[model samples]
Target chain A: MIHEYLIQLLTIISIYAIAVTSLNLTMGFTGLINLGHMVFFGIGAYASALLTLNGVPWYFAMLIAGILASVLGIAIAAITARLKGDYLAMVTLGLVFIAIAVSRNWISLTRGALGLPGVPDIIRNNFYYMVLCMSIAGICIFIFYKLINSQTGRVFQAIRDDETAAAVLGKNTYFYKIISMAVSTFFAAIAGSLLVHHINFIDPTIFDLEFLVVIVTILVAGGLASIKGSVISVFALLALSEAMRFVLVSPALIGPVREMMFEVILILILLFKPKGIFGKVDV
Target chain B: MLSLNNICKSFGGVKAVDRCSFKTEENEITSLIGPNGAGKTTIFNIISGLTNPDSGTIRLLNKDITGMPAYKIAQSGISRTFQLTKVFRNVTVKDNLLIAKNTSEAEMKKMLESVYLHKPLDAIASELSYGQQRLLEIARALLKPHALLMLDEPTAGVNPRVRQELKLILKNLKKQGKTILLIEHDMDFVMDISDKVIVMNEGKVLREGKPKDIVKDKKVLEAYLGK
Candidate 1:
């Protein structure tokens, strides 16, 4: 039982690594604030879950899911291209709300928050190792790394530093923003799918404010714009959350205490070393 | 070829710019000289599309293009440097060159060397001496090899040697057929290098002529240079 749980924990960590790493690509390199990151994750999870549940082959379902999620990312980016700084953050926040709302209302397709279940493990027959392998090797993980180290990545950073200067040099910043947003969203979808299979369920609540808070914490604590920082943040925070439950040893360990704990930690860090563990840009 | 016609601009009851009209030909260094509040920089903003004139037409290559966004205007072949040289402070100089974002490594090196900064490519832009920073601004403007370039007070706070170097580069840019528009307070430097000189007073052109003629014009002497 311990071995199974350990495998499950590693698998979860791997999925978070991919998702947060992709987030780092935008937040770190492009200086984009994407509060609606979970929407992309949910989109990818559902696209694959629904298609395969209807008898589509696993690989094809995943492919379709990735494409759909990436396209959704592009759409959000294009819509928010003109917005900058705080306005951009607000726009993404609205996206999260709207996505959850759609998931709640679209019962015929998303089952209207009754929740999607029985999503087959990405490679089910092989059990723990199978799921673990899928989670680690998912397109999201592979592509996130690839995209960040490219020439495109450098341009994104340049734009982040001084967008006006970048624009004058012939960079179509609007188009590039869309491209970066799409790529980040595609990975979010992959992470979502991993969650769906592990729990054998999906619901609008999976992308709630609390979930967003966790993601933001991971992104911040790990470091903004640093892939390495984000990955470490995911592992550290997930372990902290999961281990804290067992350590309680008293109650089911419910409630608002986590937020308070995080709040205190956030304040302490901001007062002391606010740049995050590995942030090279502004804190 | 850069030209402005009937350009009038007002800001909150103050006429920062009023009834301005001017023309600049290709491959020539043209300087706009005026008193501090006489609207020299404001005119630069209008011509560079940083601000739209309340009423006027801006033409580049003889095509009317008024009220275009600053970056778009830049991409359409007019590049500008700020009065306060805006460098990417956080990045290294090489990275600064890299941030131009579309240059070949060859072109970047060529540009840096043109401003004699190729050797210190690893230095941070902000860490450079005041003169070096000024030169970097020009090199940055030259990085695009832009058809029409505007520089606001390029020598205002620069050291003498650095100022001389900048004048040399502007002369070379003109020789290379890149039209250069500049706002300068140094009459000697402006007159020495300019193929054409424009004298402005109270947001209007006082006279436009050859350097000698502009200096000799009676009104030009009284309104500017204290001659």
Candidate 2:
């Protein structure tokens, strides 16, 4: 039984490994301070959940989620492209709050706050062997890392280094940023879909600031712009949070103590290592 | 060959570039110099498509290129370095070269050596001293096959000896048949290399002439140097 739980835990962690790696691509390599990146995560989750509840096939829901997230990403890029520096960050922060509001209030499409449940699993009762689902997840994560280190990858880093310099060198940074966000959103959406499918239920509450915090923790605590750091950080955080669940064993410990512990650890990690465990030191 | 015809630009109430017309023929090193506020850099920006002219025509080999995006302008065989030494500070010198370059390995190495940044290929661009950074910018431009290269204040903050080193690189560029437009504050560098000098003051071309004539031009002296 513990072994099965461990597999489930590892599988859950594999989803985050994909999500945070993509975030690392954007925030680390592109040097875009995208605090609202969780909007993409929520978009993916809600997209898959809503589609599946409406009787769409599970695979189609995942496919549509990537497209919707990509369009949303381009829309965000269009809005934030002309704004520079801290202004861009502020615009994205506003976007995060707006996304939460929409997901909570948009009753027609998202079923509002009631949430969606009964999402059919990919293999359903035959999740015993579990070979295909986990293999696909691992392959996707591997490719995500490979792409970030390619020649196109260096161009993204160059844009972060000096935008105008990149522009003059024939790189369209607006195009690059949009593409980066889209790619990041694509993976984030996939993670969300996988999550919804695994849990068989999801709602607006699942896409809250709390989830955003965990994603950011994985990215920042793992290291800035480091793919390996992102994957490592997620597992470390999941392990820490799981350990905290048992460690904080006072039966009287009440009202989201796990969350409080996660918050405390996040503060401590950021304080001691702002660049992250494997992140480059900011100079 | 690159040409600008009747280009005019104004910032609010002030005219920055007014009815300016100039052409850089193939392979000649041209110079633009003037007193403070003469709009030399503004002309550079307009010619290179960094800023659009309110009214004008820009052509390369008589192909109209007015108001094209800056990247397209670069891809069309025109590239530039800023007056303030625009370079990627975090990236290495070789990466800086690759940023503009779309050439093979052998040509790239030759381009690097031409500007004297070849030896420090692995050094962070900013870690190279002030003069080396200037050369790095110029070297960055050379990596591309540009017909017209505009440099704004390429040697602005460099010491004299290194400025002289930059001068040799400029001469080599001239020898290689690359048309050059340079904005310089140093009178000696300007006079030594210019095939034709265009002098401006208060956003208009005050005089255009041979280097010796520009040196002796009375209005050029009075407006620029307070003589």
Candidate 3:
């Protein structure tokens, strides 16, 4: 029973590992301050859940969810690509609130605050599902690793360093920016699909600002722009957080203590390793 | 060959580049010299598609390139270096050149040698001296073959020795049949290398001629010496 529980916890960590690594492509590599990135995850979850509930095949639902998320990413990029720094961040923040509002109020689509339940499993056995998600996450990371090592990867980092210089060098920055966001959201959607199916439930709250904070903390703790750092930070932080769950304290205090502990650890890490444990680029 | 016809750009209500027109013949060096705020850099911006001209047409190799995005214009065989060196600060020096476009190992080494840059290939760009950063930018621009190379203040802040090396590099590039457009405040360097000089004052092309004639022009003298 303990083995099953540990595998389930590791599975959740693997799913979020995919999400954070995907976000790193933008936040770490491209220098996009995408606060509302989880909105794509939410979109993926709802899209997949709704389609599967309405008799769509599970694989088809996953594909549609990824496509829908990518479309939204392109739209956001189109509108926000011209805006940078705080303005772009504010726009994405506004989008996150709007997404939550839609998820909370659109009863016809999202069932409002009641949440979506009964998502179909990828594999019947929990351990097998864990293996499948790990495989998917591994592949996603591998593809991103290759992409970042190519010529296109250099341009992406170049744009992050200086957009005008990158453009002067003949890189179509606007196109690259859109492509980066689209690819990132596609993988984020896949992680979302995995999450919804694993827990068999999802809500607007699952994609809230609190969740974004967790992702940011993980990325910072790991290292911005370091793929190895991101992977290590995910496992280490998740394991730490999971171990905290076993503390022999009052259950109510556990949540607050864990939150406070993460904040303190994050502060300490920033003080010593401003770039994170493996950060090559400053966030 | 590159041609600019009546290119004009205004910021707010101030005209930065007004009716700027010129042509660059292949395999010659043309220098744009002016007093500060004479719109020399703005004209470069317009030609390179960094800033859109409110009115004008640009033709490169006789193809219309007016109002194109910077990257498209660059892809059409034009490359430029900024007055402020814009080397990618975090990446290695070699990675900086690779960011422009892929080149083989031999080409990368050749470009570094052409610019006389002896810095280790893996050194971070920001760690280089100001002159080395400038050379790094030039090295990056030379990574890919372009019909025209636009350099903005390439010698600014470099030591005298590096300046001489830069002169040699420009002369060699011109000898190789590359059209060079330059903006410089160094009169001696301008007079030494430029095949022709265009003088601008108050956002307008005040005069154009051979280097000797430009120095002799009364208006050019007054533009520099003041009334």
Candidate 4:
């Protein structure tokens, strides 16, 4: 029983690692304040779930879901190209509301509050599934690491530092912004697919503001603009939350207490270490 | 190599640049000098495509470039430095130059040397002093491919020694056949380096002539110290 629980916990961590690291690409590395990142995850989960339910294979469904999310990400980046700082944050946050309304009201496609259940699993065994999740997560991180060191990554940081300066230097800032958003959302959606397949069910509520808060907390505590920071923080924070499960006497208090702990930790990190544990770049 | 034909820009009710027009000779330093609020920086912005003119045409190498996007203008062979330095504060010196245009390590080192910026290539730009940051900005501008170079008050806030170094660098760039346009308030620096000088006041050109001749003009004197 302990073995199974550990495997499940590792699986959850691996999936979230993909989501937060991808988000770090835009929010941290590129300096885009994307508050609606969870919408991409939601889109991926729903797209993968819908496709797989209609006799499509899991791998193909997941890939398509990621692409769909990327396309939508490009759209959002283009729409918000002129906005920056808090204005950009507000517009992206509005995206979450629009996504929720569509998912909840469009009953025929999403089944409304009654989420699509029984998401097919590619790997039936718990241990093997955990390994697969870990492998994919590792590959994603490796790609991100390689990208962060490339010329494109440098351009992203340049744009983040000062858009006017970047443009004066002859960089097409708008085009690069779209590229950052596309890559970020693509991986985020894949993480969503992994999550739905792991739990074998996904609802609109699963990818709500609460989920965004958790992902953001992990990114912040890990540090912005540092891939190593994200990876390390994800493991540490997820492990901390899981450890709380064993210490808490009542299962009912686990959820509330875990949330309280995250808030306290976030507050302390902001007050003492605003840059985060491994933040290499200033926000 | 570059000419402005009756360029004008207005911010709300105030005319920042009013029918301003001048031409720069190829491979020469042309200085635009004016008292405060004479629209010198506004003219620079209009030429660089950072701000659109109320009505005017800018021609570079005899090609019409009015109203083009700033990046496109830059790609078309115009490079510039801001009135206030705009170096990428978070990144290394090398990364800052690379962002302008990827060049060889030897080339970047040489460019840094030309600006008299002796810091290591790996140094974060923000860590540099204000004068050093300004030097870095100039290096980045020079590293980018360009036929025309524009400096907006290049020595506005630098020490005299750095200013002397900048004077040498601009003179060297001129020897290499690069057309240069600059806005400077330092009278001595302006007279020393400028091949030609254009004076402005109340959004209009007060005088345009050789640096020696501009200093003796009564209108130019009156514009500097109002009648």
Which numbered prediction scores highest in TM-score against the true structure? 4
Which pairs clash in the backbone of model 4?
none
Cα error, residue B13 of model 2, in Å, equals: 2.6
How many pairs in model 3 have backbone atoms within 3 A of each other, for residues 3 or more apart or on separate chains, i.e. clashes?
0
Candidate 4 per-residue lDDT over residues B54-157, each given as its tens digit: 89899998999999988888888899999899998888999999998888999999999988999999998889998899999999999899989999999888
What's the residue-level lDDT of A256 in candidate 3? 74
Ranking by TM-score: 4, 3, 2, 1
True contacts kept of each: 0.25, 0.48, 0.77, 0.69
Best by lDDT: 4
Q: Best candidate, DockQ-wise? A: 4
lDDT of 3 at A214: 79
Of the pair 3 and 4, which is ahead by DockQ? 4
> For model 2, what is the C-alpha lDDT against the true structure?
0.78
Clashing residue pairs for model 2: B83-B152
What is the C-alpha lDDT profile of model 2 across B1-227, one tens digit per residue? 88888989999999999889887777788899987789998988877777999998999877888998877777787878887777777667777777676456676677767776645567777688878888888877767567788888887889987777788888887777778988888889889988989988888888888899989888888887686
After superposition, which runs of candidate 4 have C-alpha atoms over 4 Å from their true positions? none
- Candidate-wise lDDT, in order: 0.76, 0.78, 0.88, 0.90
Chain B, candidate 1: TM? 0.92
Model 3 misplaced stretches (Cα beyond 4 Å): none
Per-residue C-alpha lDDT of model 2 across residues A223-275, encoded as one tens digit per residue: 87777788778888888777755677674673377677667767877888887
Judge candidate 4 against the unseen true structure and give its global Cα lDDT, from 0 to 1. Answer: 0.90
Give the per-residue Cα lDDT of candidate 3 at A194. Answer: 88
| Docking quality band of candidate 1, CAPRI definitions | acceptable
